[model samples]
Target: MFAKTQAAAPVEAPKATGPAIVPGVIDFNVPGCKPEYPRASLRNEETGTVVLSVLIGADGSVADVKIDKSSGFRGLDNAVRTQLMSGACKNKPGTVDGKPQQTWTKVQYVWKLD
Candidate 1:
């Protein structure tokens, strides 16, 4: 009598660990590219944190910026928006599969005066 042989199980590929996709971020370490506290806001003593939804392109450019949470001061919010859109600083694009990809991320700015 012949003995029956069993087939080996198939091996599965290793899954990705940790975060699947990296979130985009705004880099303010560029020369002449720093967040400026709105002068009007400072004069008015308005201080608050602004939360923005920024869409950064794969090319590290600001595609779109929308205010998720306002700082209760239009001037302050607009200032941050303008600075980000000016291309003065670099925006780190999100990545997937180790490749740059257009992704939206949350950005926060505080409008405070010393």
Candidate 2:
């Protein structure tokens, strides 16, 4: 099971003033999905923000994930990757011209110990 990230907000492209850009409207806020801290990481008190560059397909599935930044712990990094690959961070794909289109987006997972 996974817990929801406190801030699931997305970093979307800027709005259109004139004509829309290749990077159209994107809803970075993907609710209901969050990365979970693995027990190993928790036991070791590992915490940091894992920045991810994700490629979302037209169907809203996570097609690929690249670690833009890591938490510096092997366990944490693996856990974050696993969580995302396992569909814990899936979201609705961004759209262009009122149609679902593949898009590149950034997601950050801040792991904290409580």
Best by TM-score: 1
Inter-residue clash pairs, candidate 2? 10-28
Tens digit of per-residue lDDT, candidate 2, span 14-109: 986763323222233455355567888778888888787877777777777789888788787777667666654556677766677888778777
Cα RMSDs, all models: 6.4, 18.6
Clashing pairs in 1: none
